[model samples]
Target: MDFGEYDNRKNRKVESGVPDVCKSEPCMMGIDEAGRGPVLGPMVYGTCYCPIAKSSLLKTIGFADSKTLTEEQRDNLFVKLDAEKANMGWLINILSPNYISNSMLKRNKYNLNSLSHDTAIGLISRVLELGINLTEVYVDTVGDFNSYQAKLKSIFPNIDIVVSKKADSIYPIVSAASICAKVARDKAIKNWKFIEGDLFHQFDYGSGYPGDPKTKQFLSENIDPIFGFPQFVRFGWSTASSILDTKALPVKWSSKKAIENSIKTPVISNFFGVQKQETVKEKSHKFFSERCLKSVKNLF
Candidate 1:
């Protein structure tokens, strides 16, 4: 409840409810983020001060990878965590899709890893304002582990940072931070849906992950008119770009030149000394066929 006194130095890092190598060190803070990949919603970063003595309590709250837990499970865990902890502080940055798009356009690149690291650093800096004698911090790596640590160090020259891949899975405090971040993001998304009204109603895009069929359907249907084919959807990302490009234009071929140019005319290839030419159809047929082939290949 008293966010003012929260300090990273009073919390120690533990691995899966057990104190291992990090036990000898003093308490530290754990940081993580959520909703980085989603085309919708804001990017949220969370940091928590977990003491070495309360590692068991964190485990009992179902602390694990946020990706592995359901929304209900995360919400439940977040509630329990809020009730048990007093040294936890959260900082959320609500970046709209439009703002993200503009940044990508201005930068001429989409750097999600860098963006995530920056957000995490912002939250960590806010936590440091309380002057909790925080010497060290742990974060789930968004880019090169060492680079992320260095970036955090540059921002907060005094704080020692450890950035590891899958740190949430390996560190109990990091996992707790993950749950907090996820729950906060999910709540923000739900609230956004309520505020956006009918726009979210037509598109019941379940979480914004690529694995979600509803999300893909929503993107396919609305990306062109509503979201527009811009940097907001991560133009560098194949999925986002593919959806935007495919949906932006109409399926119908307007002219003979368009159809002819679109056709995939295969060149002759020698297979075991035998050469053959394949006549490939144009437009949707060829595109759908190639996509299907690629999908089939990935499955095996």
Candidate 2:
């Protein structure tokens, strides 16, 4: 059999890339991941398997891509689907920022994408362990959909993988998987806060997405003084590495009297020039000013 030619399609299997069992029976599983790009959270994988007969129920349950749903909507649907489904499983693979940083250094690879694919494979393995017969699996594409499918297939030789650019949006089950993954990941992150108290003081850090200013600030504030970057930061990243070479100079502040005196005193442009006549003030004013200036300067 030429496995290269089999393909997964909506109602009908294509001549190429179609699984032999899918021709006789539809055994489908939807796969997705959450927290792939987050620098401070765990990467989660979700897989939901249902018989072909129940596929329509997934749509009725309001399952779509997790991205398309608001947090509240996703939370609602996640609870509903969790109670409704026959067999649903999830794997929350915690990837700390420190672990990610080390992985980048040792493997010379981007931790986000690496964790995404790893989590996807992990869900697939769990599905197999549950003894569910999986013929074709649909997954939302992260990077190179085909490459991700190939990687999954390499690990599970007989598994037929269907990877689409937005499979989660198209397939209800994939969307459900996305919701489960996201909800699980969010809960895990919240729980982590209690466990790692004060470690991540800036709560506004918004899940470490690149667009979040709080996340950037958190990273900036945590840099190692000697190494110039935090041990938990991905130093290989340009943003983290740049912090190492940059230094913030200390800012000096002067007392009010010192500032006033400095402005009043004529700055000598050339020491060799004849001394300019000094302006004299009232005896009382001069004495009080002198005493104040002396006291302020001594305080510093």
Candidate 3:
């Protein structure tokens, strides 16, 4: 699309010399994500791509592991990226907490790992569609590295793909991706607009981690009776689940058996009008337990 028009903030993307970046020169792209562990805010997947020869320029610009850099340092690097738009390009996908929670809560259960893998694959495919000649891709991962790498290889057979635990520290390009992703996630949390009320009015949920006392307190106190917390909270997380199950009203989720057996099917004896009384064996609690176990085992 309009790569030049893409902005960095507010979940914007930008690129330059589209055709040249697309297929005219061999390029390498780095993939990294932020906010995966957070219970609040959106998870951001970011990818940065450049011509293979200029990858070293990433180090020259002071791009390194995002975690090691201070917030100001990350901002400065992004500023440099903006200045050198011709050589570097990046894009990001912001995944809302509501979307993540809903995915996991679905009947078929699409977990976070699956969502992450799909998002990364989508980013790579999007770059290729824009006509960028992506020859190699390096990705940072918290899950199974080999499986994720294999999955990317299966999808993009021609391109080389490498998935590592801390590739963000090892690869400059991935480090760049990490910075972009982190900045995007931080902005999302800071700029969060709550549907219930003003975000600033709500207690500061520090970093949205379970270990953060502020975050825990915010989650425990801010839970809504009807809607749960605002859109920024991942309600399906274990932290939220513990509070909900014990403190909030009980909620019964439907299952396959519950849906199919809304009304119990009448036995043949009922149709025949037979008056078979409950036997002494059937009256015993153990007999009911045995019958329930049989039914459960049948389903499996």
Candidate 4:
């Protein structure tokens, strides 16, 4: 519940329970994300796992899709989940709005779907790293359940991976993951401390979706003539960028032409449009392709 850690790192995790107990039993894990569609706060990836036999206990506590639960009900369930710490574990990965915008707007265009997949994979990897005897994983699908499922399976060949359109509703573990993500995101938004000096002071950004009139009002009212938006806004989102392009002053980068040449196109980009159509792709280092690292011209 501490925002201090999150304030320091745009990306951070909240972990509950240690792994020693999990190492004794076969575990089932689930992952779901929150705030993906919002033009506001961080997009969060949540994961929770328990002994396969104890998963039924999750259903007993009324873990269900976060969207269906009232804020009070979700809060109550979040507390209940923590009370079950003896047999369950959970982790939340918070990807800040700034990080999301940076990744999506990077010269190579990292894109959301790729970011989601990578974040989900990283969560699973974290569970494994903590020494859990993980055997199964359930995921709420992001794009093309079949392809996404296949991709997860390929990376984690030993685990039984299931990606379903409504896994968050169908699986108690996935629902629990949704609760983890939703509650954390809500807390993050409520306590957000703008490093950008006082502009407007309020937590009235509405639902943070593009369609919300209050959110529209907030974006329009807060726009800076020279700078695009505060870090809280996802500057790369079409919802935010479309406004910036029309309202904010234009800024240009010097490395508009070239930087890392050896990076190859991400496979997920083939499914979603993240590539430059007119610009011919440049080849990347074999090491870069193999390790997902890119050579930067400068550290700054």
Q: Pick the candidate with the highest TM-score.
A: 4
TM-score for all models, in order of appearance: 0.64, 0.64, 0.78, 0.82
Every candidate's lDDT: 0.60, 0.61, 0.77, 0.85
The CA root-mean-square deviation of candidate 1, after full C-alpha superposition on the true structure, stands at 16.2
Please give the TM-score that candidate 4 achieves against the real structure.
Answer: 0.82
Query: How well does candidate 3 score on lDDT at residue 218?
Result: 90
Q: How do the residues 176-231 of candidate 1 rate in per-residue lDDT, one tens digit apiece?
A: 88887777666655554322235645557767776678767766765545335322
**Candidate 3 structure quality by residue, lDDT tens digits, 132-242:** 889999999858999899989999999999999899999999998998888777666666655455753568778788889999999888886754566667878999888
- Which pairs, if any, clash in model 2? 5-16, 5-17, 6-16, 6-17, 6-18, 7-16, 7-17, 7-18, 224-229
After superposing candidate 3 on the true structure, give the runs of residues whose Cα lies further than 4 Å from its correct spot. 1-22, 199-202, 252-300
Give lDDT tens digits, candidate 4, residues 1-300: 454644612687889876466888999999999999999889999988999988788989989999998888888898998888788889999998878887887889798999999999999999999999999999999899999999999999999999999999999999999999999888888777666565544647799999999998889888877755777888788889888888988887556334444445678757777665687778995434422346776643
Q: Is candidate 1 or candidate 3 better by lDDT?
A: 3
Mark the 10 consecutive residues where model 3 has the least summed lDDT.
Answer: 1-10
Query: Which candidate do you rate higher for TM-score, 1 or 4?
Result: 4
Model 2 local distance difference test score: 0.61
Where model 4 places Cα greater than 4 Å from the true spot, the runs are: 251-300
